[model samples]
Target: MEIEIATIGGFEEVGRQMTAVRAGEDVVVFDMGLNLSQVLIHDNVETEQMHSLDLIDMGAIPDDRVMSDLEGDVQAIVPTHGHLDHIGAISKLAHRYNAPVVATPYTIELVKQQVKGENKFSVDNDLVKMDAGGTMSIGPQCELEFVNVSHSVIDAINPVLHTPEGSVVYGLDKRIDHNPVIGDPIDMERFREIGREDNGVLCYIEDCTNAGHKGRTPSESVARTHLKDTLQSIEDYDGGIVATTFSSHIARVKSLVEFAEEIGRKPVLLGRSMEKYSGTAERLDFVEFPGDLGMYGHRKSVDRTFKRIMKEGKEKFLPVVTGHQGEPRAMLTRMARGETPFELDDGDKVIFSARVIPEPTNEGQRYQAERLLKMQGARIYDEIHVSGHLREEGHYQMLDALQPQHVIPGHQDLQGFAPYVDLAESQGYAVGRDLHVTRNGNMITLVE
Candidate 1:
């Protein structure tokens, strides 16, 4: 059986991650994602109403036209997680392929929500729910397995395709988190077992987002502790305190909610995304929030909640909102601009429990948001968080564990792939031999 891999999208950048593995006549695609920064760069771009070709033209979503060249039946469209970068394109593009979208429960629920919000395309693809450590047959010659992994979001997994030639590991975005806050740790034992199997790992396609960073990526528990310490220090501040983070980060939100209660503040979930993600997590039994906790998504409801917070004393409530990256329309940005009912008084505290994404667009927008908040006498607490991507030392450990015959650096651009390339070379993987540094819409034949 022949094996071929397609570097569809996200090979050149950190977002819009899509990759396909063809094991003989059966093909499985991983992560039909979106480059959110591309869409955000444009003013008032409503992707929900946009067409797939238009999104592709704008480079916001994967240009999957290259899929025609790969001759195989798509057995599954598997999204590794629920992050927009991993599953945002599903509603737009999955209708084109006659395959089910398989993912963990949380990711499947998020995908369902994303599909319902679509206006241009009617994505009726079956949403299959599979848990971590589950296995399913693909075609007749292959099996698909999900290895539980730890990341910024809950219920993330690295999908593996087992074939006659060997095992193809679709290792996109994850960190080596042994002590997580919400989910199980990264399954290194499973990875080592796969590495020592009879066929071993044929190829390892990795996320190189933080490959340039020197040490290992810290655990989500570290960020949880950091957030607790920050909130506790301001326990006695009689002014308002607002917090923001990735809406998909259920673990972080849980921590914020717990610590807010500990510090004598009622934590309220504000913003559309904050309500959508957290409410979904709570509804799905992935998280358990206090019965009195409030989640307000609509503008009117959020404004009403803010008014109540004002009436009840701002010092008694902690509002966790969206816009950690300073999105123009997110709740935090609205608060910073004074467009919302909540007013920032002198010495008011605003905590960003997330890092600014390294894109120029996000950095500029975040800087502007911070400036506006500071102008209103808001004190900013930034970067009380740890990254979700593996760093240099983690890459060395992965290579040692998997020992794949082919290594492809992904989730980064040419400049970002440089550090990982040098690191792979040190491990005796040569360029064009075993280690491949590629771009979008390219194909590499591993066996024929």
Candidate 2:
């Protein structure tokens, strides 16, 4: 049997993650994602109006012309989670393939939503839902399995491809979170089991997003506790307070809503993405919120809600909004710019439950948003969050658990892969031998 892997995208940057693994006559692709930073860098760029090739030229979507190099039938197009960087390009590219889009239920729903809003392409790919602990046949000699993992988003999985040559485990975008707030823990137990199962993991692809950082990434519960403490400390303040985070982070949003009530404030979710993700989660029964918890997405409804919050007195509510990274059109930026009905007074608090994404564009935008908020006399509370990726020690732990024959560093550029390479070398894996450092649109043949 011949086995090969393609590093399609996201090898040169933090977003637009797409990879394909070909096992003999069958191929399975993982994550047809969009480079959100690439799209956001341009002003007034409507992705809906743009074509895939044009977006690919702008580095917004994966240039999948390299797929022709792999001679196999694509059996499945799997997205590990619903994050934009993982599933954003599905509507644009999935229609080009003849495979079914297989994913966990939440991710499948998210894909449907993305496909719904797309107008340029007709994505008529079949959708298949599988649980985290489920398995399906890829071809005559291979199987696909999904292992539960902890990430910033809910219902994330690490997909493993089983073949006669060996097992190829796609370990992208996860942390060793044992006590993740909303879902099951990072299934290190299953990973250890897979390491000892059958051919014992031929190639292990890793997410190196935080490999340079020391120690392990903290559990989501730690951030929840920090949020509780922060809100409790400011309990007595009789002024408006606002908080923001990744709307896809259902656990963090639930924590904020809980703590807001604990501090005698009615927490209301405001913003389009916030309403979309939270509403989906609630409808899917992944979470339950207070009966009266308001989630307004449309401009008119959000504006109406803001008016209600203002009319009911700013001190009575906690607005958990969008724009954690200060995206120009997000609700928090609009609030900071004083374009919303909500007013900021001296000593008013603004809590950032997300760390600044380490990109020049995001840094600049966040700085400008903070300056605007501060100018409005809002006290900024920042960095009250934890990363969704594994740190140095966590990488050490994963290496010990998987113990694969080959290792591949992914989800970061060459410089980002450097720290992980050093860390892998410390564990006795060399750069050009068993350890492979690769880039986008490249292929590695493990067997032939």
Candidate 3:
């Protein structure tokens, strides 16, 4: 048996993540994602309409070609997590391959929610939900194993595929968070066991997002302290207290919710993305926010909710809305632009519980929003956020644990993946033979 690996996307750049592994006649695809930077740069498409390939072509999705060669031989489409950069392209592109989409429960639910609004391209692919530590056979030559791992989201795992030729592990987005606020810590023992098993890892595709950053990533606990400190310094105000962050960031959301509760206020969530992701986390039994929290998906519904909350007053509620990156269509941008019914009052708190994504459009849009909020006399609290990816020391630990024959860097460009190459070399792994740095559209074949 022989194995061939190809980078359909997410090789030379950061988003539109797709990778294909072909063993014999069957091929398994991992992560059909969107390039948020490319999307904004080329198409000028709204974030909500990014699922369409036409808009994607205009720059919303990565420019790499989908694996048309595996259209019929595709066995499964596995998404490692729920981030938009991983599963966003599946509903739009997976149907062509006619394969089952496999993921942890929350990732599946989140993907379903994303495609639900698109009448033209509703998600109809077969869904197989495998819990962490579970294994599922896909074909005669391959079995997929979900190894429980920790990330910003619950039920995130590393996908280990046992193939006829050898085993391949996909470690796209993971962190060794010893103190993850919402879920259990990383399963180091399980990873070690897998490494020792027969057909032990032939190739390990790993995330390179934090390869350049030094040391282990700071835990969610550190972020919680920062949030608490920021809140304590602010005086109580009469206007709405709004906070915007990554929807899948359950730990950050939990911190905000707890802070709101401490201040004698109810936390109200707004926007469909926020509600859907939060619901997925709750359904997966990750965290339990209060049942009284409100979420508005439609404009009409949001307008009504805003009116009710305005009458009830700011002291009664803490509003958590979308548009942390200042996407124009997101709820926070609409409110900042005076498009939403929600009113901004003097000395009101608007906490940006996220970092500004460095893409040019995101920076511009966020700048506009900050100016508007300031003009309205709102007090802005920015940069109360933490990264979820593992840094250099964490990557070294994973490399030490899963000492595979070869390492293929993923999720970032050459500059981002360089550190991984350096790390492997320091461990005596040769650059060309044992270390493979791939680009989009390139393929690597392993022979035994």
Candidate 4:
């Protein structure tokens, strides 16, 4: 039996995540995503008029040319979660293969919404829903399994491929959170069981975005505590209370809603992505918000809603908007610029339930947004959040739990992956041997 892998993108940089794994002759693709920085750079370009190839050339989407040779051998395209960084390119690239696009229900719902209003391209294959812990046989020699994992997004999973040679697990974006607010914690028991399989795991490919950090990542529960503390400290303020974060973060959204109710403020969700993910969460029964909560998706509706908030006094409403990364067109950035009817007074509070993504593009965008908010006398409370990636100690624990034969560190550049390499080496794996180090477009082959 033979297995080969390709890291198409999201290897040296942080986005456009695509990976092709082939067991025997059957091939499976994971995470067709977008490069946020590149997408932001071409912000004014109309995607509907651009060909997929042009976007690929512009670095907006993953270049699938690495798998050109296996064009007809592809079996499936699977996205681990609903984040655009994991599923954005599906509508643009899933048409390249006749394979089904399989993912959890929430992810499927989000993808359907993404491709709904566009005539640029359509999904040529069926959208199959496989909940966590479900398994599907891809071919006579290979099977796919979804192991539940916790991350910023709900219903995220670690996809594992079982082949005649051994099982290869793709855990690119997850953290071990025992107290995730909306979903069950990391399925460590399943991980340990896979580790003890007779064949064991052939290779464990994992995310190393936080390998340099020490200790485990704080749980969503901890972030809820911090948010509560911050909000309580500023509860007596006489102006608007606006909170912004990743719209796909259902756990954080739920926490914010609960906090809003606790402080006697009506919860009003504003922005497109906010309504998208929150609606999915409600439909899937992943979270339950108050029935009377106000939500708006379209621009006109958001404008009308904010206008009413301004009329009724901003202190009476807890408004949640997009642009946590300070994206130029996000709702929060527009509000900072007085594009919305709502205004931020000198003592008004703006809670950022997120940390800066740390990429240069994100850093610059955030600086400008904060500068604008400060100039308006808005009290900025940033970084009142917990990361959704496993820290160094958590990485060590995951390695210990899933004692795979070989380790492949991904989702980071060389500097970010170094700590993961050291951790795997400490566990007796050898670099360039059992512990493989690779970059985008590079293929690694293993045979048994």
Each prediction's whole-model lDDT (CA): 0.95, 0.94, 0.80, 0.88
Please give the range of 10 consecutive residues that has the lowest summed lDDT in model 2: 424-433
Q: Which stretches of candidate 2 lie over 4 Å from their true place?
A: none
Q: Tens digits of per-residue lDDT for model 1 on 48-81?
A: 9999999999999999999999999899999999
Better of 1 and 3 by lDDT: 1
**Model 2, span 1-448: residue lDDT tens:** 9999999988999888899999998999999998888988999999987899999999999999999999998999999999999999999999999999999999999999999999899999999999999999998999999999999999999999999977999999899998888989888999999999888989999999999999999999999999999999899999999999999999999999999999899999999999999999999999999999999998889989889989999999999999999999999999999899988999999999999989888999999999999999999999999999999999998889889889989989999999999988988998788999998999998888
Q: How close is candidate 1 to the true structure, as a TM-score?
A: 0.99
- Better model by TM-score, 1 or 3? 1
lDDT per residue for candidate 4 within 108-166, as digits (tens), equals 88888866744688666788999999999988878999999999999999999998777
Candidates sorted on lDDT, descending? 1, 2, 4, 3
Model 3, span 1-448: residue lDDT tens? 7688888778877778889988777788889887776665544455555455574555545443546653338888899998888987776776676788989888888778766755556568888888888898767758888888878777798888887656888998888877878777788888887777786778889889888888888877888988887766663654578889987788888888888887777888888778777777777777897787776677788778888888888668788888888877789988988887778988888999888865567899899889988888888999897777889998888888887887899988888788888988998888789899988888787763
The list of candidate 4 runs beyond 4 A from truth reads none
TM-score of each: 0.99, 0.99, 0.91, 0.98
Count clashing pairs, candidate 4.
0
